[model samples]
Each structure stands twice: as C-alpha cells, then as structure tokens.
Target: MAKKNKIGEYLYCITTKKDAPKEFNIKGMEDSDIRVMFYRDLAAIVSKAPLKEYEPTEENVEKHKTVALHILKDHTVLPVALGMVFKKMGILTSTMGRVYFVLKKSLNLIDNKIELGVKVILPKNFEESNNGKSIEELREECKTEFAKKLDGIAVESKEGKLFSDRLALNMSFLVDRNNIDKFSDILGKLDDKYNDLKVQYTGPWPPYNFVDVRIMSRGK
Candidate 1:
C-alpha cells in the first residue's frame, strides 16, 4: 500500500468574520476542499493540501490568486502571501492570534477599497506631433499633469517600473469601490485630451501594491 500524504491547511487570504461567507464552493491547491478557520474576528480561508512546499508554477499561482479574487466578490480581503501552508491547524490559529491587532488595523484602513493600474505610453511619432519635444520633457509633463489628475481620485498610489522608454507612467491606484467609475471617467478624459499618448488602464483587483501581508509558521 502507498503511504498517505500528510494533510495540511493552505491559506489563501484573511477576512473579517462578518465578511467571510459561511461556505465556499471553490476548490483550492491540489483540488482540495476549501474551508474557513477563525481566530476571534479574523477568518482565514484555507484548503487541504499535503504538508510540503508548493512550487510557484503558473497553474499553482493562478489557483492561489483565483481563490482570493473569488472572495473579493463580497468581502474586503487582506491577501496573505503565496505558498503559506501550516502543518497543523493549531499553528494556523496561533499565528492569527499573534497578528490580531495588525490584521484588524490593516482591514480597517483598506476596507471597501480596490486596486487599479494605469500605464501612459508615448506616441511613436513624437517628433512629428510635438515639433521636437524631447523624451525628458514628455516624461515631466506626464509626472506633473497626468499623474496628478489620477492621484486626486485615489486613496493611495504606487509607481511601477517602466520596462520601455515609450512607457512614461506606470502607476497603481488604491480607489474606493464606489469611486471606480469616477476614476475611469477622469482617466478617459485624460486619454482623450492627450491623443498623442496611449493610456492603458486595468483593474479593481486586490490591493496587492498597498498591503504587505505574510504570516509564516513558527511565528516567523
């Protein structure tokens, strides 16, 4: 007979008891049944898995993210880092106990908020459109004018890396759930006014940029 793999709880994300649903209809890592575990007011969404390190393969990463996004449909979540598996349920409960206050504070600050992304690209015919404006000049305009307009509508904003010279502004905004449409409206106007610049907007995704949550075993 084959030896059975040791069962462990794989954590997806954290939510308040009020926000966490009584049951989840989704599957998690290893196609295991998903369930909730609580420590006081905080609820941890978890699923069964073998007691081992799960590699960050494309499929596994998607499974992890999908669960969190599913929760976001009805709750404000504090997304725990990827690949957090507790060998014992007691350890999971204790870990939550240790970080109770921090979790509560974070949830309070980010409640009912979502993240959005924007990338402003320079037009190919830069010299023809603007007579002879330099890339530096265009970047400055993006920073002062375009950035400020979007920042006004967001609770918090983060600057992302630019992979190419054409990519002038790469930003992530933390916007209220209700103000998503308003944010889109402002971005649309900016896009129209700056016809020479190409704007790419995305999300209402989990606030990955704003929150840094990682709860490990053994209280580390």
Candidate 2:
C-alpha cells in the first residue's frame, strides 16, 4: 500500500509560460494550493497530493476539474487527465520536458477556443410529428445538415455519444472565444427552426475535446 503521507506533484493542466499567471488562488485535491511550475517555455498547473492514486469520486473529480476551469477563465488550457500524480517534482518536470512539443502543438491548436456541447433530443412523439420518419433517419439528418450548419461557425466539431434512441445528435464544438455570441445566435436560430426538438446546450468549458497531451517517462 502507498504511504498516506508520501506526497507527490498533482498536475492539472499545461499552458505556455507567456499565458500562465505566476499565481493561482484556486484549491485542488486535498485542498492544496494550486501553483505554476515552469520549464523554460512551458508551464504546468499543479498542486501537492498524496502518492496514492485518487479515487474517481464526484467531489474528487470536481476538485480536479475546478482547477482547470479556473485557469481556463483566463488562458488557453491543455487539461490533463484525472489521477495524474508524479512521485516527485523532478519526475513531473522530466515528463513535461519529454512531452513539451506535443503539448505546445495541442495548445496552439486550441488557443482562444472553448468547447461547447449540444444534444438534440427528439420529442416523445417524434415519429408521429415528423411524417413517420424513423429515429435513424433523423440521426442522419443531424449528422449531415444540422452538424454542417454548426460546424461552419466552429473551429472544429466532434460527434459525441448519442446514448439513447431519443437523442438525434450529441456533438462538441471548438469555438473561438470572440465568436461565442455569433455561435449562440446561430444555435438559437436552429433551435427555433426545430421547434419540436429539445436542444440541451452546455459549456464555455476547457477544450477537453480538442487538446491531446501524451505524457512520457524519462527512460523513453
């Protein structure tokens, strides 16, 4: 069993040095102070944590997400996966050095961008109202025409899980911060056009769907 008192550096996310603020007042897991650690051009947002793996409880996950969201409010964030704990600061720094380029590339891709989610739910009497069209037919329409209209206004769009027969579309959009209002306007128009469909919209969230960071050990 891991020692309860053995502490490690818990990473929340990565951003460029120019973008990372010198201090963060947000709290992380174990209520540790969130701070920035620099390695030349890169900066890691991290906090002190136990060496043991953290359980994926609602509160634990929320604490981890809260730190990234706090950073996202001000800067472009490349959010790290949950449960990332390095044995020591040195190892954390080394891993950062190894994946520096990949991290930088991802950060560039998602700079000034935020993720937004939309799920279109069919009305209970979807088939009856829509000329007896099957759910699968509506799903195709969502993937083609509906998705294209939104994608035209977004930097990128990815299809998420439909999760249910009533869900016609589940998608995430990477949209520019400046264009959020424009995107909302377009979304509003779509919502009105499809009066019977239920649209569940979410976020201004960290670009979790867009940024991909791969951590490597020192030996590799």
Candidate 3:
C-alpha cells in the first residue's frame, strides 16, 4: 500500500507555448504550489500533492477545477484529469518526451482555440418537465440546428466525453480565439430555443474534453 504521507507531483494541464506566468500563485491539493514542468516546447502544470489513495472529495475536486479556471484565462490548455500523481519530476519528463510527437499533434489541433461547453439538462420528471417533447428528438434537432447555423464560427464541434442518462446533450465547440464573441452570442440563443430544457453553458474552458494524456508515475 502507498503511504498516506507520500509526496508526489500532481499534474493539472499541458501547454505548447513556452511562455508562462513567472510566478504561479495557483495551487492544487493541500494548497501546494502549482508549477510548470518544461520538456522542450511541452510544459505541464503540476503541483505537489500528498499521494495517498486519492478520492474525488468535494474540496479536492474544487481545487482541481480552480487550477484549470486559473489557467484558462490566459492560456489555451489541455487539462489532465483529476487524481493523477507522479512519483518524481523525472517520470513526467520521460513520459512527455516519449510521447512528444503525439502530444504536439493534439496541441496543433487546438492551437489558438478554446473549448466552450454546452449542457442540455432536463427536469428530473421528464413526463411533467420535458414539455412532452421527445428528449432524444430534441437532442438531434439541436445538433442539426447548430451544424446548419454555427459551423462557420466553430473550428470543430463534438459531443462531450462525460455522459449520463439524464443529460440530453453534452457538447463542446472548438472555437477560434477571435470568434468567441460571435460564438457565445449564437450559443446563448441556441440554448434558449428549448424552454423546457434547463440548460447550463460555460466556457472558455481548457480543452479538457479534447485532451487525454494518461501518463502516471511509472511513465504509462
């Protein structure tokens, strides 16, 4: 069993740009310093963390999101999921170096782009709350509507990775930096069409839905 007090590097996100804030004031688990590890052009935002069996407790989950939000304002980041820990800095470097080509490919795909999220939610009691519209039919209609109207503004649009039965639609758009204003305006209007569906839209998020770097302490 891993020791409860073991200390390790907990990764948060990655960026292709070499320039970063000289002084990183954001933090992760235990309020430890959030710092960047650079391997050539690839840099990962990581923080020191206690490496016990980690769980997604409310506090830890909040800290993880706080770090992502802090980075999103300035940088287009590729977020690592919560609960990642590296035994040492060297493992991170080796893992990144080994997969440098793939890493770069994903970065280029989202360059100068950020992810905007849209969640289509329905009332728990669909019979009374769904306005008698077929939930699956509405989801399909929303997708078709966006493709017809907003395809020009979005670099790409795809379904969100997170899934649940109650969710009508989970999606994110890869929108160019300059087109954010136009994109958001259209999205807000699009969401309004379904009055019966309670929608939540948030954005300018790090491309967490798009990135999947699963390197652990032992370098995969």
Candidate 4:
C-alpha cells in the first residue's frame, strides 16, 4: 500500500525565556490541543492529525485565528503562514536555527515594541476614475496631491512611511509598546478627517513583516 501523505503542521515562532511556559492548552478546531515544542528563543506550537482533519478549508482557516489569538496572550509570536513544513526533524532543526538568528535580530530592534498595521481603503468610484484622466495628469494632480496629504499626516503622527495607492494608503508603524494608546488616538483623528475613506487598523503584534531570514545551507 502506498504510504499515506502526512499533513504538515503549522508552527508558531515565539520568544524564549527561562520562565517561558512549558504547556499551552491552545484551542483547536475540533478539540483542545497542547503545543508540543520549544527551541532557543522560539516555540513551534503544533499538533498532528490526519490530513483530512486540518484541510485548508475556510472553516479550518478561521480556526487557526483562534490559535493565534490564544497564543498571543503570553508570548510574542511570529505566526508562520499556513502550510509550512519540513520532511524531517533534521530539516526542521536546521530551519529553526537559521530562523532563530533572524528573529533574534528583529527582537532586538523591536524589544518591548509592537507592529501596527494601517490600511486606508478608498472608494470604488475613485479607483474607477483612473482611466478617465491622462496618466501623467492623474499622477501629478490626484496621486501626488493625495500622497502629500498622507505624508503630512504621517509626519505629524510620527509614524512610518506613507505608502501611496490608487485611492488608499497602507502603512505599518513600529511603535513603542507604551505608546499604542497614543497611536490609536492619532489614527482616530485621521479617521475623522478622511470620513469617506475606510481606515482599518489591527494589532499590537510581533513584527513579523520586519524580520527577514536568508538560509544559506540546507543541512541534511
């Protein structure tokens, strides 16, 4: 008989400490599952099950959010995207070793810091008007005008770069942990001004997008 394909489990990258909690009763889709492993300054919270049980169904994907929310309570975690895996323990260990260094550096830069995601969504009518005007005219007149406005807000808010889009702007700010409330207040003011645009913000999360890992060797 052909070997059954094992479902690769998802892993969470977490910070290490002497007092790090050993056991976490993370609520899973079907049942309560305990996180199983911890490495240097990183934890791989995983549970194994038949492929069918954790298929990439819409329901299963939503369940993963529960896992993330529960884990975030105690540890700063870089959530590994869904469907991450390795063929064996050796590969997993090697991968973790490389990831550990990158995460360590990011943690140093972001110690006691949080990542806040800010996305400004523009109205559908604004997006549809792109073809009506000459590209250069639109670029100079509308895009640049809006970008300058966003930049002023970014400067005043003292947040990160102001990313420009067709009608929206997306920005990720690395703010001190203590200043999150103040940051939210600033965002509230921006929301008041741009009442037509939708301003969505999320998190006080670990700086996942800021960490970049380049693994040179694949140790067998």
Candidate 5:
C-alpha cells in the first residue's frame, strides 16, 4: 500500500540495454508508467506497485508477463521474481550497482536465446503405425525423433511434467533466436509424422526457464 512517503517499484525483469520498446506500454497496479531504470549498461524494467503486502492476483501476474514479453522481443532479459518492490529507490540502485557485473553476465549467458514449449497429447486408446503397436511405444519413438532433430540445433532442453493422463510429452527447449525458423521447420516435420496425435507448440519467450536471476532487496 502507498503511504504519503512510501511507494515502490514492481520489477518485471532486467534487460541488456536501455532502449526498451516504447511502443509496448503496460500499466502497473496503480496505472503508473512501466519504464527502464538504468545501472551502467543494465536496465531494470519496472512499474509502480505496492510492496510487502502485494498479492499476485491474476491481473498483476499478467501485467508482469506482458511487460516482459514486449521487452523480450528484441533484448536479452533476466526476469526478476514477481511482486518485488523497493521502498526506497536507493536500495534498488545500490543492489543493482553491487551485482551489476553478475546481472550482465546472466544477460550475456542468455543472449540471443529464447525458450520454446511443446506438448503432445494422444488418445487414451491410441494405436501406433500399421504394425499395431501401443500408444506408449509410439510416444517414445516420437520423443527420440524430436530429440534427434534438436540435438545439434537447440542449445539445451528440459523435460516438463505431463499434466494429464493422455499427455505423452511436455517439455521445453532453449533455442537460439537465429535458429527459430529452423526449429519451426523441425517441428513441422515431426507434426507431419505424428498426424494422429495433438501437438501444441508455443514461444520464443524470454528464456524464463533458462535464465535464473531474482532480485531480493532487503527493503521489504
């Protein structure tokens, strides 16, 4: 909550550059400006929101992601945790200054890297090729094929939880920005090969799963 003297900044993430997209603007909880606060070559993408007592409501969560997505379109961003606020701007500045090099190193680690998601769902009673194999058998084959395709292309990959009984595959891949089109092409081929199942693909999102940087200020 904002008192007469205490208002805080909601940090969305840290970007490699200061030239964030002015075209894509997002309003904070108090309908304030979401802009970059700089520290040398680093920039903290933030907006105004109440601190300590802040709740991660659906609206607030979406606002955080919206800002990150926009800035991520052209920059390498290290996403800060949600609901982070600094009572005094000095604390944030000093924190960023203290860890400036660490932040920059993280930015460089994720440079030109983006995350891609894939989910595959199969029918509970699904059958395999004309050979009459089981669903599990076919799913494993599909997994291997996809991995082989991305072996040298994608930088790294991690498996995710299979949310439902019918969900055969849920995973994320760290793909180079330059190879997105190539990644898409590989996905297309896999999709064609497994036409009977449901495959959902998403992102080019700021490697949220890959880069792990969180700003913990003592102000709260």
Candidate 6:
C-alpha cells in the first residue's frame, strides 16, 4: 500500500469493464505519484499529483489528456478534469456511496456510446459585412439556427434530450456507438451545407462532459 499525503489528492479517469485498459503510464509527473485502482468491474486510473501541478499550462493539461486518451482507447472512460481531490478515504467513499446509483446509470447509458464533439469555427477573416458583426450577435444567431435544426433531427431520431438545445447548439453529442458512421456522414453533409464556416469534429471520447462526481469537500 502507498502512504497517503495530507495535502495531496488523487485524480482519476473512471471507466467500465468493457472499455478499461489493462494499464497506463502517467507522463510528466513522478511515477510514485500515480496509481490505478479497480472496483466492481469499474476502474479508476489515478495519480497523486499536487494541486499546484494542476495548473492550466499546456504541458500539465496535455498530461491529463494523455492519461485520458490512453484509457479511452479501449474502455468507456469518464475523464475527470485536473485538480480533483479528496481529503480522506471516508469522504471519497461517502461521495461514491451517495452518487453511485446515478453514476452507474450514466455508465450504462454511455457504455457503448461515444461522445462526438462538433465545433464550427467561423472564418478568421471575412468581408466587412460579415466581420463587423459582434461575437455575441454571431453566437446567438448560430445558437438559434443550429438549435432549431438539431432539435428536429433529435426528435425524428428519438434520442432523449441529453441537454437543452442551447447547450447542444454549440456543444458535444453523446452518439450511439453504432451510429458513429452515420454521424460522420451527417457531419460531412452539414459541413458542405455551411461551407462558409469551418467545422471541426473530434472524438468517440469518454463522456467527459456528462458524468459528474461530487466530492464533498473543496480544495485549497
């Protein structure tokens, strides 16, 4: 067993049995600082890094992505953000106990599902007629237009509203695993339809945006 530190916290990448990786390497941090734990067919790839190490620097953030990507390759990982902490094991246990049902339900819902992140990047430079519009105005216009279109698709497709249309308008979609191909096709069609904007899509990722674990205490 490893000795526990009073001020440090373990960050975890949670995953299900079908998608969990056998092992993973934690880069850009001490080997002794990281550890992996498994529980009842679920696993948590964890590391004991200090709070200061969790800053938004490119290197540190990349380390988080590195860990998440490695696990996500095989398992349906719940990628927790950097800086998650627990003061004691009891707190960790308590939080898990309180939320395990919800977590499990979410896990099952997302088991074979993969998250697809779609972003439409407007042209950096356009004619003055297009460029002079305020970002807020463009954002609202995009939200309204995209929401109407996507809501109709969602209804026809019979997928429950995972989130409000406002959130989904400029957001990610937790697509069914089997629908990835069809989803890609739709993305391509949309891209061609709005060729004026640059559309970028990423993942098949663990549903990082959806799962939330409430640790009872705050960090310093």
- lDDT (10s digit) by residue, model 6, range 22-118: 5555553434345555556665666655544356677666776777777766566666766666655455555666666766776776676667776
Order candidates by TM-score, high to low.
2, 1, 5, 3, 6, 4
Model 5: per-residue Cα lDDT at residue 219: 62
RMSD of every candidate to native, in Å, equals: 2.9, 2.5, 3.0, 6.0, 3.0, 6.3
Report lDDT (CA) for all predictions: 0.85, 0.82, 0.76, 0.55, 0.77, 0.59
Q: After superposition, how far is residue 219 of candidate 1 from its true place, in Å?
A: 7.3
Expressed as tens digits, the lDDT of each residue in 1-220 for candidate 3 is: 9546778888877876464555677667898998878889877888888766568899888888788778677776777778888878888888888888988888888777888887777678675344555767766776677666667798877776447666877778788889999987887787677777777778787777767667654542
For candidate 3, give the lDDT: 0.76
Order by lDDT, highest first: 1, 2, 5, 3, 6, 4
Per-residue alpha-carbon lDDT of model 5 for 82-114, expressed as tens digits? 778887678888989988988888887888788
Which digits, one per residue and each the tens of the lDDT, describe model 1 over residues 116-163?
Answer: 999889876465335466777777777777668978889999998898
| Deviating ranges (above 4 Å) for candidate 3 | 1-3, 124-132, 161-166, 217-220
Instruction: Determine which window of 10 residues in candidate 6 has minimal summed lDDT.
Output: 153-162
- Model 2, 154-202: lDDT tens digits are 9999988878878999999999999999889888988887777898889
Q: Which stretches of candidate 6 lie above 4 Å from their native place?
A: 1-9, 17-19, 26-34, 51-53, 87-94, 127-169, 217-220
Look at candidate 6 and tell me the lDDT of residue 197. 65
Q: Which stretches of candidate 5 lie over 4 Å from their true place?
A: 1-6, 22-24, 53-57, 124-131
- Show the lowest summed lDDT stretch of 10 residues, model 4: 151-160
* Candidate with the larger TM-score of 3 and 4: 3
Report the Cα lDDT for residue 52, model 6.
47
Candidate 5 has its poorest 10 consecutive residues by lDDT at: 17-26
TM-score: model 1 vs. ground truth: 0.86
- Worst lDDT run of 10 residues, candidate 2, spans 211-220
| Candidate 4: tens digits of C-alpha lDDT, residues 1-220 | 9778654434434455542457665655455364556667556656543333346778776666556556555555555554444445456666777667776666566565656777766655464333455323543443344445444433222233444454345556666666777778777776786565677888765554565333323432
